[model samples]
Structures are given as structure tokens and as C-alpha cells.
Target: MDKAKEIFKVTKKTLLLIAGLVWSFAGFRVFTIGLEDIINYRGNKFISILVGSVVFYIFFKFIFLKMYKKHFIRITTSGLDKQYFFQFFDLKSYFIMGFMITLGILVRASRIFNPVGVANFYIGLGFALFLSGVLFFISFSNTKKIKVQ
Candidate 1:
């Protein structure tokens, strides 16, 4: 039991680190490379994109995660007493995550926005989305029970 809890702690930290790294790298690259392109284009649309990305990130990091944590608690009490894992086996989450990943891949792989700063913003946004989805997916593997002190 203690071993399982220890494993969960390790895995959770690792996932969080990986997610942070992914976002950091993507943000760095986007700022350094995308800024120049954005200046060249001289379009104001990048501002909107940047604002939108910030909003989305906040929503996911706060609202979405909170909802998921609640969902996790609910599921843990539903006869899965020995586990405190992520509950993501439902089709809704699958579709939402799949769509986000696919969209990110497509945006990152396409050259249509190469000359625009919005492209870089989207590239970073997509990478973050994909990474977060992966974090959530891996979050489902724990079998540890959360003990109340």
C-alpha cells in the first residue's frame, strides 16, 4: 500500500514535469522564432491569438483540472477503493482529447501559417494541449488508495 502510494507520487510529479517542459520549450521557440515572423507580417491578429491561448490555458489548468479532480474522487468512491487514479475511460473525454491532439498535430505540421505569428502561437498552444492530454492519459494508471489522516 505504501509502495503504491509512493509510485503514484513519483508518476504524478514526473507527468507534471514533462508537461511543464513541453510548454516551456514550445513557448521559448514560439517567442524567439514567431516574434520575428509576427513583426514581419505586421498583423494585429496575433494579439487576439495570444489572448485566446492564455484564456484557454487558464481554463484548462484551473477549471478543467478541478472538474477532473472532482470526477476522480467520485469514481474512486464507486467501488474502486484501492485506487485514486484518473477516471478517463469515458467516450466524452476521449473525443475531447483526441480532437485537441489531432488539431495540434495538424496545425504544427502545416505550413499555411508559416508567415504569421498566429501560426507560432497556435503551434505552442497545440503542443501544450497535446502534452496536457498525455498527462491526463497517464494519470489513469495509479492503483494507490488515498488515506485520510
Candidate 2:
């Protein structure tokens, strides 16, 4: 059983790549949903897009970038030669992600806020996530280069 589980082990670089792919995919999905919502909104589309852009800038600079740096450091500093595929994110990260996802779902479903506002927020968040994924890919490349040296 142990040996079987070992087959699922992956290098840190691979983990980084996986993380990038997952985040990018999720970002794309969320972004599209937001775009669709904005398109259907009766309010001003330009304002919605603008709000989204601002949200993206703020979230990326203030939140996602910091998170990327922290996670990148953690991945690079791990002592293990091989880690489980899902180990790209620590347990705390997984829990936080779960909580955020649940919260987002609940908020969207409750419809207490305006749909246009939600769409703008989603757009901003999605862009930040996609950029964060790009950062992970860059880190993966740099780590590969270091290993080759």
C-alpha cells in the first residue's frame, strides 16, 4: 500500500505546475461566469468592467501576490525529495480555500447584493487568481533552472 501510494508522489516542480494549472483553470471559469453575468446586467457595463479591473489590481497587489510569495517560499524550502500530489498546498491553505469557496457560493446564492456588483467582484478575483497561477509557473521554471545548474 505504501509503495502504491508512492506512485502518486511528485516533485516540487510538478506540484508547482499542478498548482498553476488548477488556479488558472478556476480563474478562467470564474471570469467567464462574471463576464456572462455582466453581459446580462441591466446596469452600466463599463462601470462593471471598471470596478472589476480595480478589484483585480487591488486583490493582486494586496492579497494574491503576498500569498504567491509565501507559498512559493514554502514549496522551495520543503526538505522532502518527493511529496504527495496534493501537497502543493498545506492543510491550512486547503481549509482556507474551502472556506472561501463555500462563502462565495453562499453569497452568490443568497442574492442579497446586486448582481452587477457581484460580477465585478468575481472578475477582479478571477484575474488575481490567474496572475497568481502565472507566478507559480515562473517559479517552477526558475526552480528547474536552479536544479540544472
Candidate 3:
């Protein structure tokens, strides 16, 4: 029983730590896009990122927090087995999640190759990837609780 509890605690901490890393990576991409836009386009991309972050925070408060609070409570109070937390993360989801993280890395790595020889296009692609990263973060955040529609 003690060993099981220790393993469970470690697993939960690892999961949360990974989530935090993903969140920070997404934030980094957003910030990088803003800096690139300012340097390349001389526009208000930085301000836009700030606005977007504020909007995301507000949305998370009203929606994600409410939804996930119930989920956390249900999972915690039900002896973990009732929730079957690991079952929610099947093989397919793992594959897809791995692909997303790999794609994000590849997108950032492309900056090194400069295969296109077009700076504007490269920056635009990066910004598009920045959007994708934000979407990835949102999707991953909600994966803990699968909603049936």
C-alpha cells in the first residue's frame, strides 16, 4: 500500500510537471512570434500577444477552471480507479500527442535550414505554428476530462 501510494504521487507530479513544460513552451512560441513580427513587420504583434494572453486567461477562468475543477474533484474523491485516469489516455492519444510535440519541434527547427530562402514566408510559417502551439496547449489541457457531446 505504501509503495502504491508513493508511485501514485510520483506519477501525478510527473504529469503536472510535463503539463507545465508544455504550457511554457507554448508561451515561448507566442512570445517569439511577437518578437519576430516586431522585427520583421514593424507592427503591433507584441501588443496583440499581450491582448491574446489576457483573453485566454479570462476564458480559462470562466470555462476551463469550472470544468476541470469538477473533474479533479471527481477523480480525487473516487479512489482514482473510478475515474480510471490512465485509461483516458489510450495509445492513439499518445501517438497523436507525440506527433504534435514533434511537429512543434520540427517547425522551430526549420528556421535552421532556410530551405525556402524567403524570409517573410519563414516568419509567416513560424507565426502559423505559433497559433498551432496555442491550439495544442488548449487541447492538451482539456484532455484530462473527456466530454461526451
Candidate 4:
């Protein structure tokens, strides 16, 4: 268990990615890099694609990992002796992941406002939907076993 914690600490890609995503989003433009070719390049519409991808990718790594642990608790609660913070964290992550997924879908679906490349934007949103759906389902099952202290 300690080793796994150490690994999570060392492999902080998710944290970095989230920070990067937030920064990128604040600076995003409708066609910062795609204006040159509105048809294929999508003009400024690609910003949504990149934002959704980066945001969802971070959630895939961190939020989904939390759901996996919650599922593990459900499948086999043998060794889980009514611990503390685990329960709260799992619940919190569950809802947050759901929100992220919903937000990603909205961001991608908003491509219509950009004037081009709606399909590419949705590609990123699709991954978020899939990742969030799996994680939420896993966590939902674990909710039944509250393991009260």
C-alpha cells in the first residue's frame, strides 16, 4: 500500500496535466492556431478540441483511478476495516468526475459556435464521456457499502 502511494506521488502526471489544462484554457482563443485553414484546420475551433482532450485526459488518469479503488472496495471488502478518509475522498471524486465529464461534453458540443470542425471537437468529448461513465458506475456500486465507523 505504501509503495502504491509512493508511485502515485512520483507519477504526478495527472496533477501537472490538470494545471497545464487550466492554464491553456485561460489563454485559449476561438482560432488561435487554426485560423489559417478553417476547413481542415478548423480555424479557431480546435481550441475546444484541445481543451476537452487535455481536461478529460487528466480526469482519466486521476479521477478514474479513484473510481477503480472504490470498485475494488465493493468487489471485496475483506480487508477494509472501516477506514476514514478513503470514504470521503472516493465520494468527492465520484461527483467531481461526473461534473468533468459533463463539462467536457458541453465544451466539445459547443463547436457549432466556432464556425467549423464540430466533429473533431466531439472526438475529445467522447473520450471524457466514456471515462467518466465507467468511473461513476464503479463508484455508484461502492456507495451501497458505506462501511460506517
TM-score of each: 0.40, 0.92, 0.35, 0.31
- lDDT score for candidate 4 against the true structure: 0.44
What local lDDT score does residue 129 receive in model 2, on the 0 to 100 scale? 89
The global Cα lDDT (0 to 1) of model 1 is: 0.49
Residue 98 local lDDT, model 1: 70
Residue pairs clashing in model 3 are: none
lDDT tens readout by residue for model 2, 72-91: 77776777777788987889
User: What is candidate 2's CA lDDT for residue 15?
Assistant: 84
50-87: candidate 3 lDDT, tens digit per residue: 55455555545664344334433333344433222342
Clashes of each: 0, 0, 0, 3
lDDT of 1 by residue, 98-125 (tens): 7866765676578565446455454444
| lDDT score, candidate 3, position 123 | 36
Top candidate, metric TM-score: 2
Q: Which is the better candidate, 3 or 4, if ranked by lDDT?
A: 3
Off by over 4 Å in 3: 1-10, 44-50, 63-78, 81-149
Relative to the unseen true structure, what is the C-alpha lDDT of residue 112 in candidate 1, on a scale of 0 to 100?
Answer: 62
